[model samples]
Target chain A: MNKTIIEIVDSLEVSKVYAELSDPQSGGICVFVGTVREVTQGETVVALEFETYRNMALKEMEKIALEAVEKWQLNKVVIRHAIGAKKVEDPVVVVGASAPHRDACFEACRYLIDTLKERVPIWKKEIFKNKTVWVSAHP
Target chain B: MEILLFGIAKDIVGKSKIQFAAGEGQPTSVKELRQTLESAYPDLGRLSSMAVAVNSEYVRDELILKPGDEIAIIPPVSGG
Candidate 1:
């Protein structure tokens, strides 16, 4: 049976996502976790904040997960993103996939994160000591 | 009509949501809404791109809008 898990939560738990991706029929599992970095272009980032239009974000995430499953024939898929302020080294996003083979799961995991970033309604802000910048708001 | 704003759009609009009265010459389509917003807040016009969501789904500018529809201004997204 194929399973899809999508969530937008206050915090991200990689372990929970790992559990979700574990499938009895799958032999390969691949996961990707996005973290908050302390620096960006030499600016000291104090923290990173994420916000979303929750309803729309969930709808879009479901669309991405479905597409990955179809393309890669994945047995399981997990896509979760964290909202609110996150300190450096904190996990902000986790995406994973399981398949009968290694290549399919790896490709699907990449597709999940890349497509989510392009189409989802989530936004991120970078906080510094003196200012805050909304990521990718401008050219 | 009420429109939700997020990210820098919220910062530019100074609120997370905005409403238009019944007789306020409200926009009837996504394209018109974009024009109305750009004229009201020029800074929004300078962004790399902008998209609108109607009832939680992305729609083209030609899509007609209704007063009771859920609308949102989506600035360039930067999510992982």
Candidate 2:
């Protein structure tokens, strides 16, 4: 089994994540990155604060990686998410998938990101100029 | 049993870990645990949704809890 990397970090480096997915056996590698947005709805975002159930987040991420590989026949999967305070435009999450074919790699990358957002035990708080609110908390 | 809180749950409870004694029913099942928590801390009931995690995985209503299992409350997650 190829090494699957999953981490909840304070900061995310795109170059480092790309370097980790260097699997020569795999012919294709696909990556997806999520960044802090400058605006949320009609309000301007000043920053973002992330909270995570670290242990569960890691376990869920590993589970996601395993499921992606099993479903898409992927060779390697990397899932990383940032926690703590982050300025606008900072990287929030990164997902990389490597496989023998481009189709599997791309599909796995999308599936991993979507599943992570839905299932992982991590929360994001949006900070505006005068207010701070939890994402999805509003009606 | 002690339960760890995150996100909005932490804010509602005003602490990361909350301790409470088992009541008359001493609900061992997560379904009963939810009622116990809501009764103790009414703020938890206001949340749009919340879930219990045992041993780092979300379990269904029927899963019974051991005395010393890693337990935490998960509010609606919104990670990227």
Per-model CA lDDT versus the true structure:
0.93, 0.88
DockQ of every candidate:
0.92, 0.73
Off by over 4 Å in 2: B22-25
Q: Which residue pairs come into collision in candidate 2?
A: none
Best by TM-score: 1
Q: What tier of docking accuracy does candidate 1 attain?
A: high
Model 1 lDDT per residue over A20-47, tens place: 8888889999999999988999999999
What is the TM-score of each predicted model, taking all chains together?
Answer: 0.97, 0.94
Best by DockQ: 1
If you score just chain A, what TM-score does every candidate get?
A: 0.97, 0.95
lDDT of 1: 0.93
